[model samples]
Target: MSDYLEMSLEQLQKEHAELLAFNEKLDRERNGYRKYAMKYAKKVQMIESLFVVPSDDHELTIKAIKTIVERVGES
Candidate 1:
């Protein structure tokens, strides 16, 4: 704190600009993680939906599994 008091206006402005840039970088990274989490959550929900109702149709189960595998592969 006392060190800041000793800084010139130019120094303070430079430091402020650097901090702002770093903050923006962190925000971008946070947003990326948030998007990834949402995508993963949707995939998990899809998997859960498949099991929610017990289905005796083997063909339907196979199709669902194939769809899931394709989606996973795409990711």
Candidate 2:
């Protein structure tokens, strides 16, 4: 009877160990998605800088800004 109870306990522990390992794999996949999202966000920020005015082109900068606003509004 003692041996039977010990075997049952060992089986339960093994199943629990498998579940913990699967959870870790899922956590890793979720972190990978978060890293990709951060990369995309950085790219968007770089692209948005095209709308900023440099010191040399006052009129052209105004026009570019207007065009950017219009395009953004259309989207």
Query: Residue 75 error for model 1, in Å?
Result: 8.5
Q: Write the per-residue lDDT of candidate 2 for residues 1-75, one digit (tens) a residue.
A: 234456677787887798899999999999989887776665556446865644586686667656654454232
lDDT by residue (1-75, candidate 1, tens digit) is: 439989999999999999999999999999999988887777677878898888999798888877875685346
**Residue 15 in model 2: lDDT:** 74
Residue 52 Cα positional deviation in candidate 1, in Å, after optimal superposition: 1.2
Per-candidate clashes come to 0, 0
Candidate 2 runs further than 4 Å off: 1-7, 52-75
Which regions of candidate 1 deviate over 4 angstroms? 57-63, 72-75
TM match of model 1 to true structure:
0.77
